[model samples]
Target: MSSSVPHAKPGGRAAAGAARAASPSIIVIGVGMKMRGDGGFGAAVIEALRAYPAVVDRVRLAACDGEPARMIDLWQGYRCALVLDAVRGGSERHGFVYRRELDPEVGDFGAQPGGTSHAVGLGAAARLAHVMDRLPGRLILYAVHGRDFRLGAPLSGPVAQAVPELAARIGREVLGALAAAAAGAGKPAKGG
Candidate 1:
């Protein structure tokens, strides 16, 4: 991951507060690289989400380059952030969705010499955000097991086929989070 942090104005606090007041609950940052096969999953999910009218007003969609610092910059103003990425976790055959709550204490995943090419890795960005006290209390990572990361125009078979399902799952998760937040706010919850 690159260490170049995208510089945002110091006014992120006010923007965050205003976003919170105007939205249903949280923000979603879809991190992906279109040139890298399955790595484009995040972008695909966002496209799917855009077709859903129910969520258009409640969520903010951002397409990231998978650079850790850039990712952090994108997430700076949300109450909760859900990061979607493609991972070669060796569990693709099991057809499972990999989800993890990233601990801000763990620095960037790409910090290691041979780690992913993502600049500054997601873990590192999360840690930096935490240290800066700018991290959302609830941050979730959804990693879809990927079969290929090769430079290509399309996703590998397994990952490509998983797109619709992944999109639906993300949609459900977002709805659930929103409903829960609403309930906590003493408002009638609408969706599951």
Candidate 2:
């Protein structure tokens, strides 16, 4: 259950060099099933990101089955991580994108049970990981509203359109984080 996601080169060889220069990495976990309609949003995002190797390398990528226990194994050791998935049952309209920054101190993730397929939601797993000291220091969840969960159905049109845009946004965030980390590392120690 070690991370098999390689250090991807977003822009190619030149980008790989840049990635090597920058530090502090981010992990992106996509949770869903490819066979299920829009429920497969997470895998879609991961697929879109695969086009950018540099981005893929900078960020650890995981396509999960919405199983909380298995997900913990993929994210261990990372300080910051982002999770992408499909969700239902919120005030948000279908195709709506939502972002939630998790607070490790919060025991209850407050995630509505049916939003995702797992018996224990991503939030509860996160809380459990927190208790076990396995949770990342900073974690963000980005959920895309799903319109269908039918087995073997293709992703709905609207959700399909959002995948590339979401991937690009995540790419920018990854680069920004790396840049910030590099800048911070270059700074002299406060006490020195």
Candidate 3:
């Protein structure tokens, strides 16, 4: 199954304007279900970001059901896509946030059986999209450490406490990307 995510139109003054105007744009995808304790961290980050006016109008946020296909659709057309999800990798302790280039060759992502409720695996979706020439210019995967996937309505203690730090880091990254994009466009960097 394929899906298409909507894109935001660029906004700013004409080239002749005195000041540089950066277009507000960003796509943040949080993938998880509410019942799976720490698995819901993605959604929590989205919720927190929504309350910030500075980012609310600049970023497009979506809650995905941990499905790669849906995530791909939701991220299409955005210049940058940040995927937030809970991951189970034995190398790291719970609640740790790790950022790295998504490598399809070395990870538990390959052995996972069955399509997630959303239709594909995270690694597969990204790899396929890149191979198919559909990936955004900037794609990032943020895996939040999760210890419990047990059925419940609340986040586990570790995951719950990491929300603020994660959200702040994401916000900063998004803003920095936007600024960089604007700079590359030959406009003065925003806030410079």
Per-candidate TM vs. native? Answer: 0.76, 0.83, 0.74
Q: Over 4 Å off in model 1, which ranges? A: 1-24, 89-96, 104-117, 187-192
- Scored against the true structure, residue 47 in model 1 reaches a CA lDDT of 76
- C-alpha lDDT of residue 186 in model 3: 96
Q: How close is candidate 3 to the true structure, as a TM-score?
A: 0.74
lDDT of 3: 0.68
| lDDT, candidate 3, 1-192, per-residue tens | 111233334553343122212433567888887777877888888887777776777777778786666776666566777888787655667787776554434322333322232335577778777766667656777777787777785887888888888888888888777777777999766899
Instruction: List per-prediction Cα lDDT, in the order shown.
Output: 0.67, 0.77, 0.68
Model 1 error, position 61 (Å) = 1.2
Error of 1 at 47 (Å): 0.9
**Would you list the rank order by lDDT, best first?**
2, 3, 1
Better of 1 and 3 by TM-score: 1
Q: Which regions of candidate 3 deviate over 4 angstroms?
A: 1-24, 103-120, 187-192
Question: Worst 10-residue stretch by lDDT in candidate 1?
Answer: 107-116
Model 2 over residues 67-92: C-alpha lDDT tens digits?
Answer: 77777766666778889888876777
Highest lDDT model number: 2
In candidate 2, clashing pairs total 9
